[model samples]
Target: MDPTGNVGLLKCIYNIWKKPSKKAIIIYRWAKKMHDKNYKHIPIFLTNKLVVNYGSFISLNANIGRNLDFRHINGIVIGDGVTIANNVVIYQQVTLGGKNLGDFQKGNYPSIEDGVTIFAGAKIIGNITVGANSIVGANSVVINDVPANSVVAGIPAKVVKKLSY
Candidate 1:
């Protein structure tokens, strides 16, 4: 049996069934697909259902890449127009949201690059870029751009370490 074939499919199904976060992610993916296919009403309904049932609010407009891994899903709010790259891991209570309320604009949300790990309770606000392969420490408030291959922590997060790879 090929691991990337039926076995992988089954494992993914099992994981989704066992985790609420994965279930929410799957639902969001489905909604996004439906939305892209011009099936508007159903996607809106599904998004509403997910927000009500899972405590996770993900904008259908957010562009997320492959292998989006969520450590926990509770209180995760991903705002509109946020772009997330591949292989990004996010923990609980994380907010990738706008800086100001009732002041909408294009490119107002954070752009998370590939291979980034955002720990629990991290709030990444406004139009900042979290560079590839970087780590956002838990409970950190990030208001500025983070360089690639670095670790950032503390309020108004600053680079604490630069990773080699």
Candidate 2:
């Protein structure tokens, strides 16, 4: 909470993200463990944290890379066998889980690549793959496979923007 405008806060945030502090990693692991215990509570606590602020009640088995940046920890559920790359930013109310939770199956999870940014209230299920540098908008429900450097939105997550970087 900075006294200045949003830009200053964003800049400060960027700086911290550029080089994640030891405290941040520690907190992230702590949050991960907390998430393991209670995915519901982790988001609320994570949102307040300067580091990783995420949500949901799930057993995330993703390969989360280093220097993660969780913007606004919301109602996110990361299931087992999922993978998250570096510099990935996940917003509130997102779900990353298996398609069939009741039917247990190995190696069936979502894979989120590097430099990805998932907006608030998005739901990603099944054995889908979110390409690198992709963006999933708020409240979008993703069930299909998203291309690299693309922006997906809407009820079923349609690609709206194609990132050229």
lDDT of each: 0.92, 0.73
- What lDDT tens digits, residue by residue, belong to model 2 across residues 47-129? 34732333334343345777666565445566667888888887666788888864236677788898989988898888889
TM-score, per-candidate, Cα-based:
0.89, 0.67
Q: What is the lDDT of residue 13 in candidate 1?
A: 84
C-alpha displacement of 126 in model 1, angstroms?
A: 0.8
Best by lDDT: 1
**Residue pairs with clashing backbones, model 2:** 39-56, 43-54, 46-53, 53-73, 61-80, 62-82, 62-83, 63-83, 74-92, 75-93
lDDT of 1 by residue, 9-104 (tens): 998889778888778888899999999999979999999988788788999889999999989888889988789999999999999998887424
RMSD of 1: 2.7
